[model samples]
Target: MSTTDTSNSPITNRRRGTLQLWSRTLIPTLREAPAEASTPSHRLMLRAGCIRQVGAGVYDFLPLGMRVLQKVSQIVREEMDAAGASEMLMPAIVPIELYAGTKRDVDYGDLLFKLTDRHGRDAALGPTHEETVTEMAKGSVTSYKQLPLNVYQIQTKFRDEFRPRAGLLRGREFLMKDAYSFHTTVEGDGGLNETYDRMYQAYVNVFTRCGLDFTVVEAEAGPIGGSASHEFMVNAETGEDTILVCPETGYAANVEKCEIGDRDWSFDTDATTDLTKKHTPGMPGIDLVAEHLGVKPEGMLKTIVFAKIGGDKRKYVLATVRGDHDVNEGKVRDVVGFPIALADEKEAKEAGFAIGYVSPRMAATRDDTLLVIDPDATGGVWATGSDEKDHHVTGFIWARDLGADLPTKDQQGGKIRVADVRNAGEGDPSPRLPGAKLVARRGIEVGHIFKLGTKYAQAFDFTVLNEQQKKTTVIMGCYGIGVSRTIAASIEQRHDEWGIIWPVPIAPYHVVITVMDPKNDEQSKLADKLATELVEAGADVLIDDRNERPGVKFKDADLIGLPVRLTIGDKALAENCVEFKLRSEDGKGRLVDIADAVKETLSKLA
Candidate 1:
């Protein structure tokens, strides 16, 4: 958790000199990686001997690979500390009892990597440690004085992903820095909100200092069940994610919660014409049906099938958005006022609703009926399902002739109904900033932070007595950084055909000192001088002292892409100089005297 212990670690000094430029520690380079590696990041990372596949979505990190991992972790640690967070270690193998109390053991279910111990008790490789951390706090801390406690750990997490690819970017087993904060209230004054904003600011600094070009976007808390969450994404062409962004205002968020521009349509209860049925053969879909009827997209109706909780089978919801527009499921959920999943076709058939032929009039007219009409779906006379095969009802009014009132089927008294249940598309407007419409970008998640509220604390009874001595659950927030994925992400952001271009702060070695044809005393001597000087100048240097050909050494040098390279060759000796190469340079190197070259390259790295 702290660097003080690193000084005494076995490999800190003992193995530093043993690593050879071409022979050991790492494979140096592989001529070819497997064809399965689609992106440069996956190929280079494998060819560089940083990682190897152990399972479909799991990896084994080699020594040099772990050294870079530590450097990345150290940066995260410093940033978390700067934000006044305390560091702790949590076990990778966690007991299921902790999650049982949170009632999320089943929530995780198949996504959890569960195994039984010798004693035959269920345990899991922690995907994140909210349950463990809150349980630990519950057993020890109780006073309100300890109301705000922040703890974090850099640990390996596991998930049972259905499909895994893109190397470490979405692996089943990977490294994560997850932190959870406990508070006493939900208000921004002093509780979960203060910590949430603090965590957000801390995340900004963490990604910034890591040399990562990242953006924080609004996201769902997902199975973790939190009120709000944000995802840190690195923009890259090879990225696996697609985010909707506003190019005009720099507004961005995941597709799930993206907001759109304004378009309103509402009709009084007495507006629509008489409900008349008409033939609409071969009109299985809304688009085809609208075209068959000589109607614009906005002049038609669309119904979706969804299974609500406590329902016997999937039911039809005749949500009438403008024909040109799409449905936002979140709005439908807001109408139902709870979490629900869409009902598939089989369930719809069992509910006696024709798969393709469904109408507002045909659906069961009861309090339990879900009929949510969009603002535009209400006032307009439109064409919709006739509930019979190859037929439709036109000039159908939702509120006026249909006796519907504002997304409710309770006859204006009993229960709210469900209307639309489809996902919104790219044309939607900005929910946050005005004049900003949704734009698109590919993103890969690098980090995430969530306001957990009292979910974990209340589960474990992790509480503190308020001023009046009333027992109250502590509010919570959780933060995470994809440590292993950062390596793959960095390569995704900074790489070319040659090899990886790492940012300075996390590069394994600052400089590579190549003694081309080291058998020559002159070249060896000059290389040694440069290596020593650069090391003393506070640079981590890799010295190529092997008796290899000049071509081999040069090839390896460029292939590894150390930020700076120094060559002490016969040509340099003749000029009383050394060839100075900046690996990222666009042109040939310059010759400087051996002594001056060391300081010169060091300056470039600085």
Candidate 2:
């Protein structure tokens, strides 16, 4: 069997650019995924030989993975260009000083991969280029005419994740497409708002083209300090984040930012009883205390103490929620109107708090302490800490025990502040629609867009001249898309027991030509002819011409998951036809005339 040695031929090289032969490729598919590959996408990527882990939270993209990445990146590039964002590159090593000026260095904390340069100066790998890009604008963009300029880069980012799991979904080192836009105003034409909308649409187009079932939800701009933000989440069963959606009004938000509607939070006057101390030895958690008292968690108050981040150490806020509900620290921060951290047990103890047995009434023991209770926690007869070791207060009623401290209505100005400072959950009423409850869905966030306002502009001194010839700080916006994570997310959303069913647009190759007998001249000639035709028809073709059995070739084709597959065998060709299959479809596929191979493949791809 003399196969043509065209590995270096000019025509072969040209075809190799988009048409790959299985014999010349480097796919090392594993029969079984490793135990450490926890997620479906992680397991499949490993078994399909798309990536190999090099270190914790880091992986090397194999050839197949690189092709998928290139295709996804190209889609991003085209959409960004169409949205008027100019592509630019920034250095990966950023000086620590840039972040120090914005105080984000402290915000990033250990997440920044800090290093000492040769000159003894501090530097770090760029996690995001907001500071660098803002500094650049401060130096060059000083005129109103240069306003509303958006520049972006497709680059690698590093974050020191405490635990990077789920493959590329949450990696310490990964590829990202981050874009920054500078504007003179916020809402007018060619301003930050306009540019933000354009970028949002571009993201929609990009993800849509990549074939993701996603939802755009209101989100909190954590650490980035933006006024407004939204996250594009790809729906997945094994996603890390919980998304709450309102079926009636189409309002959706991540659990961290979702709001709860009005509930019947009136105090249960009939259930009120004298607050009496009861023994609850060794019961530190709400669940433990509730279990000890033979009461439901919903009828208990869970008080958590927090100290202001930059305020007096002795001063604390007692954040209380229903035992069944969890306090949202973000909502607590907003109610407190400052940054706060969970109070250290030692410091809390020193401040007259019982620590484990601390209760809402602990606010009365210290002049500096404030009580903030979630509305749901303010109504029911509750079991709470007794301000002493190994004791709890049973029959705790808000109106009777707390008295004047408990607000008459849900407001912040009272002695006992009441607010919706708890995380929303499934069946919780939607804040936007009356009588409609919030639904839950798991999602993987793929893109985020933020209206940054002037947070970075002010920090970096980025300003521009207004029409009045006066200097004004530029309004800025930040947008990010997880370039590599999208691949894993796509697999998470589209994979089956057989293998990944890659989307047509982002598949490593659009079609795989499986030759049942590569050594046979008839089968080999048919594969070459069909591959050339498909390549000319603008489809990436991978010819399975390796000396493998028919079953092996078919399995490999399904495992790699090209969008379309064409099988050429002596039996099929003897009937002047070939097997046409779609990887996304079930069954072995129907026979088609050999002459119609290219046309049918292109139709399936389209």
Candidate 3:
């Protein structure tokens, strides 16, 4: 007897039957989450038996979790396809040499998971595929005909996180939907910008379809190395990222990229107190020194030293800001137009500079040392480092102490520059609105899109012939959606104290039929009938047929947080009705006739 080919047969197209029996599936709900589960989503994921921890930063998505993942993936696929992007898959393991051009191996540091294959060749589990995708475009896409093509993949990515404590929010291995677009130009129709805008809208649609309330904020590309980027954030109190929002102007940005508006700084120039040096032993940090001198932190100057990454001649930068603020290294790097790192203790000391007490006047100590002061720090008569060990200078004004030293022109030969180099905080003036203040809000970053502007194209030499038949480097854009992180972030935003309140689109099942007394034939028969009707009406249904108490069944239904719930019991079934409830609402559900149970459940789901 020969077996029929079922792979291409109609049997494959048949539904696996949307009705899932509670006893037939594995959902081991727990009374408490593990000790390591700190975040709300992490705890709820464990309690609901959606996921189980295999190791730190590694998890096994149970049946219920897998269903949700599939739903999310499908939505992403639909949106991406609708946005004119082709879907493809790439290998998870990549050769280490591919990272040579961008030097992301060094940029990623220990976060890139390095490994050696059995052939003794060095490889890595890709944290991202920018290099790999660009290399692909370089080989086959040699003409403008293939220009403006966007390709994407929904696959697993690995990162060697030092401490991945927030479950799927920061995991070693997680699913992602990453897309790369290649184009010959940046503006106009069918250009990189046009494709980028489409992808941005697609991202908005994906998250919105997933029932996520998110905000799009200006963001730094970080190690991704792009000209500009934006992040889609889900607002939550337990989120890791801090977003600064201008209430009046409706402008929002992540803390790292937030800009501050103009501000007034009053100087006490009439004090006439001479600049005096004082002994301050064991007070190296700004806090300790400020305490010893009895001055507020805002009235003190904090100087930091940084070394430029590459050049024939060594160059150092002295960045000074108010003690109350922090130096934003990204802004400093942008101002200098190069990569920079904090000067090591030995490097600073070897250059005839005090490690902690290097003052703004130290810029005059060496020709290669350039001072960059925050604009707000220029007017005040502040306390600052004296370039001497265990000592500080009091009553030091920038104009009085370094009048001729502050150069008018920005250069490296013993001159000072002024710019905004400090992190913008909660109440800082908004860059968009004149007098509005930026408010602080915590948000989880679920998606990011970048205008790469030939960064990866140059690395891979990915050039295509333009309309003029001349070779030109391709401009690129990268868009990413954190597939697994979205699930966790959704839980963070939608869960209640009782359990997760999954939205309709991504909920494991649209409706759960709770059999109050599974042993009763009437209750079981009614549940099965209602589940079948609901499934036929385009709703995923789960029937609770386990030999558990009615209270346990009700609690499980609430804990899993299906969008709609239908209860079949001795009392309700005898009355030819069932209790209909929506997980988002409070208190008990009203009765619905058994004849209209399926419609009522679908309506609730809608």
Candidate 4:
């Protein structure tokens, strides 16, 4: 594929010329949003005539939406090229065999949109291009001389979302700018880290240029297994993911990967008494049981049984945390080093374990079972299950009742293990700043960069001969930005009740020449002259020459969300001045001399 170098390109100089409203363009504004639209971006896009739903989780971008999308793609392309990356296109439909090498076909599960061709061959839409890119690298590049190569593509992707909603935020079919970097080794300068850093900065530039209020936080790699990854999230109240931030320490992370910093834990062994079992009638939940036992929920141990499956082996693992806390399945998976599922009641019963009343004593009794205990649960005297129906154990000390072989200072020893396996709660210690507390906020993920060492390279055997003439697998880094979603995210971050307030860099047109009535020769002449001068001044201009009321034209101008609006009416034009207003600012339009209109618009755009 051929690549374009856009480093010297100007943002305001669009390839297309000036647009004329009512005749040359379409802006089908709606008074109310469609019922399916939920988020502000979704509702606004529908009302502004930027997009229309073709099916569930599928949308057709109208001219206005396409313009915004193209602008975003161009910015991404320029940034990638500036970072010394090449552009290439990959097929949207990939053969199923390509994914077989990486086992992503199974890993992606139902999310993979699989299909059967007429010749009875298996095919699937590309949800991601890691495997395909690695396969391509294997055939084309053969030595370290071709190392440190970064290639990117802006293309459509497909995923079979279980419940696709929130319009472009979680669409089934969407546009994405995905880049992959290959390196001969991960260590030293000018290696994987260098390329990864460049991509990271490129992503930062992309979001910032789009005028998004976003943050970079440590994130879980998920299906894209990697040593490290960071997600770029646009901050918003209605975002789906929770972001943990420590103000004092400048530490931030997604909840999935966030860690609680150091804190002191003191166990009141002086107030503890002998362990005793009491008869309880029913299987009440933790809150009810805490009330029954006259103890706080934190003074109880909540034991959960999980069945870990790897290859052909399935082992039942018991996980214990404070009753007030919840288990983080991802952390447990990491500890067990395998995929896990909640143990069914039947399976627990068949394994000689009580469904809800299982105790830590079972871990001591069975050598085959694995045990994981949260760090908070290690030094506390607490209420616990007695391993019998209708019975509870009170004052159960971790050291005494559980055989007292517990390792001091929070380390795995004997059969019991102590780790930070529960989800970090609000007010937990900040990992980066001592004595600082972690706070939670919501954000929408717009981009992700992963350090995907040799996972894909080894799968596809993408190797190169090093300087020493040794065959070495290529290390990789994958970075992605949702091109269309970035547009929606911008709206999510920068919109008011009136409409979207677009940023100057990516706005469809830098200025909108709103002529009240094109039939009026004075207004038409002024609007046409202003547009010509603005285009010459390095601004994309849109002339609203429609024969409509001033009120309707003004309303449409706001809805369409051009960065600047120049209103040319008989009143303003007769005064030898036109009203100029910025869409992002409040209040009435200010009158500027018609002779100075182009100069004023150019300055505002700058």
Candidate 5:
């Protein structure tokens, strides 16, 4: 693509003159701001003139913003290519039947934006392209030699977020590039691991080049069924989710799995403490109960109920954590290993799972119900449940009162496995760093590469003939780049009070030639000469050919955030010199001969 052709869409380029090419050009900004926009990224995106509000959750990308979007897409393409991933386009629209076979289509519920086509067939704007890519891979490639096939596409994806906030970080209508890889057997594991690592590194490189400060931390595999997954977060103080890190150790995780600090607390064995039921009025929360009883919160067993798969009834579990600690439902969900969500009051009542009085003893009754308890809850003289509303039993011991049903070393029936299911928090010990603690930060996810093994291939019956003439379905993996979202993320992670700091690699025009006095004869000639030299020096050059004032031109240039600025004025015209400035540095300026400016810019870029 030629520089100008690639710069803007045909429609936008024509309007650049009339519309005035800047965020100030009809920017959709709010005065008081909406309460829904929770993060700086979300608010700034609107003020920066990058995106427009199409609806409550949807957005439309504008001209200058689209340039940054395309640049992010190019970087992703380069990295995926380096990782041996080939590129192809897939349809944004998908049929419902393909999703029905996999069951996720229905299971996804409201998240999938479902609609009917002109033909009256059910369809979904693809949230991801696992089904579509595998369907393509299955029809084309055959034999074990073609065992590992990878394909990707950068396209717009639609997801109906229950609450879409954080600007481009989360949106209803957004851009995402999803890639899928097909493998035949376990032998493909090496390449899979290799490419996964490569993609991870590539993600780092892409984010770094875009001038974003972020963290690649451990994350849970939600919805996507896999053993390993990583989350790239931008460190911002206003982040909604709490992340715990061990500052001492450098271990990091989302707060759900963030491990609490370990301490020694001995259970009282000698005292003949009575376990009596007592009314605890108006204390619905554990913290409230702990304060009322003059005991630590950890000294009590907290029960929570969850609605499970294939039933209207809810299952209740006694979640015992020290009052100082918190619950990790992700760990509980892993144990449940079924479709389960936090149970409501109605579901709990019908299932005989009490809302206020729930106990660990009820979990093991062979009554066709499930109970998974937190590990720290066991082997303690703690306050527990009476199974009656408004009453609890203190001085209750686990092994003495309800023995053998508690979880053991093995993850088996009626046994609560000791695992971290709570949200990982910053300052918590890093699981990988041993004794060290992790510091937390926020980040916008610009790209994602998933090793989608057989999730799609098995669904589509995507099979190929092997060398042995036997037929087998190809295993697959998928990767993606949110081309448009990256621009917003880059800005979120790397912006100033003024505007974005566009990097040299992606900035639309590397050098903006500001004709300080466009009408001045010498200044105009000097500006034209400088522009020609810069263009010849392999820099994408933009001349402020508009008859605007020097201050106005400078303001627009700064707002645009180009890396290099070349100013031509009366003082430079006489000496055949031009003023050059680097966008990153403080208002420092250098006078260079008109000829040397080109050489200097080319050298710096080189």
Candidate 6:
């Protein structure tokens, strides 16, 4: 079947047999979610008996959960195959040497699960396979003719999460579909971008078919360093990640990577004021200092001292921003081209800087220090540190007080650097369209695609001979969908107060036949016949054939949240019909003729 096929046709049915509830399996429905359940997805997953906790951040999928997971995986496989990607398997327990090639062992930090083998060799569970796949391509593929290959696997990955909460949303062990592409050159039609585009469309198809309401936003590559990347986020109010969106321009990005439009840094007033220092003892924070000076926070300049990490020389960096704004460390790292930490009191003191009373004027004196000034603080007259303990400077204008030599770019000695080092706030101008402002929303990241460039291939020495007979490194791209987390995210997006209202595509069963009383021969026969017909007509039918009370069966049916519910009761049978209800809708369903039940159910499924 084609990947784009949307109909619930028989050709797409993977499981042919019918499921009988109360006899064949277990669904331990609960009245209340466990106290630890924080999000809607976590609560619904447990109360519906879809999953059970094995440990902190570990979970065991029950039969119903397994079925849904399999269905989701099948959809992913179909879309990936349709995108011309080959499926393969890799060992989850990867050797530490693979990561050593990329130095990800240190980069991943405590999140990597490491172990010592019996042979005294180091091993670690794979959080991702960029290194492994790059190494494999390095050893196996060696010619341009064998380039432009994409390989993927649906497998479980492990990360030693410190706080794994929200059930499957942030589990230590979870299933993921990760695909890596290799190419000879990044230039033409048959290059990394071509495959990246195809994978992007494939992700769209998978999420659309799975009936998720999601947004594709530009994202930072985090630990998976890459040139360009995007995240597929399922929109929800309770989601952890913040996304900035511009509805007017249809531009969206994760907050970490979001860029804001230029701000009007021109002086609000041309009035000049001389820099004056005054003693204010023991003012601990910006709010307190602002109050001490009888000024608003926005009228103050915040100076922070940072020390460069992972460098041979210990260098102190000064970062300045508007007092109301917080410095985005990621942006600072991008500017400094190295990791940085807040300089300790002793380090700042030794560097000839006051720990809390440093000012932009110090940049003029300390030419060796790297100074990063936020755009908002460029030309404003503001209150700031006075380079003396227990003292602050008021009416400090950048042009007048900080000297004429200011760095417009990075790493220019003896000059103050100007850049956007502050976090983009809610009302900031949008980066894309003129006059548009950015709005913030919450989202759960279910999928991500990265344009990896040659970071991995270079590290692993993955190269191929080109048509010109010269050696060229392979450009790579990595795409991943959190298969299990997608399930939780869907629930987070789609569930109601009662239970999970599963989308038709990934729900364990499409139609649930509730026989009011199994002992009633007529009702029993009718339900069995309907199940068989529904199964043949490309619907997963679950028969609630338990010898339970009518109220019990109906409640369980509602809690299970099958798309369509067929209740075979004595009253409905006397009327020569059965009731058909859609779980998403309210009220009792209208009666349909017994002979027409199959056709009506099929119509609803369509």
Best by TM-score: 2
Write down the TM-score of every candidate.
Answer: 0.83, 0.94, 0.93, 0.90, 0.81, 0.90
Candidate 1 lDDT, tens digit per residue, 124-210?
889888888987888778787876778899988999887888889889998999988888777756677788788899888877877
Candidate order by lDDT, decreasing, is 2, 3, 6, 4, 1, 5
Candidate 6 — which pairs collide?
none
- Worst 10-residue lDDT window for candidate 2 reads 8-17
lDDT of 4 by residue, 487-576 (tens): 888888888888888898888878898888889888888788778777655678888887778788888888878999998887887788
Per-residue lDDT tens digits of candidate 3, residues 1-606?
114455336756433337799899999999878898989999999999999999989999999999999999999999999999999998999999997679998999899999998899988899999999999889989899887899999999999999997999999999999999999888898898899899999999999999998889988864445536999999999999999999998888998998888875433355556799989988758998999988988989999999988889888988999989899888888777778899888978887778788789888667898788777787758898889888998999776777667644334333577777888899999999898999999999999999888889898888888889899999988999999999999999998888999999999998888888888888888888888777755689998899998788888888899988898877776788999899999888978899998777777777
Off by over 4 Å in 5: 1-39, 42-45, 188-191, 221-227, 238-300, 306-318, 323-325, 333-345, 364-372, 375-386, 391-419, 545-550, 571-576
Angstrom error at residue 82, model 6: 0.6
Off by over 4 Å in 6: 1-18, 221-227, 267-295, 307-316, 333-349, 378-381, 387-395, 403-414
Q: Give per-model CA RMSD.
A: 5.4, 4.0, 4.0, 4.3, 5.6, 4.2
Give candidate 6's root-mean-square deviation (CA, Å).
4.2
- Candidate 1 has what TM-score? 0.83
Candidate 3, poorest ten consecutive residues by summed lDDT: 1-10
TM-score between candidate 3 and the true structure = 0.93
* Candidate 5 C-alpha error for residue 573, in Å: 4.9
lDDT comparing candidate 1 with the true structure = 0.73
Q: How far is candidate 1 from the true structure (C-alpha RMSD, Å)?
A: 5.4
Return the TM-score for candidate 2, rounded to 2 decimals: 0.94
Better model by TM-score, 4 or 5? Answer: 4
TM-score comparison, 1 vs 5, better candidate: 1
lDDT of 5 at 137: 68
The global C-alpha lDDT for each of the candidates, from Candidate 1 onward, is 0.73, 0.88, 0.87, 0.84, 0.66, 0.86
Model 3: CA > 4 A from native: 1-17, 221-227, 265-268, 406-414
Could you give candidate 2's per-residue lDDT for residues 68-169 as a string of tens digits?
Answer: 999999999999999999999999999999999999899999999999978899999999999999998788887999877999999999999988999999
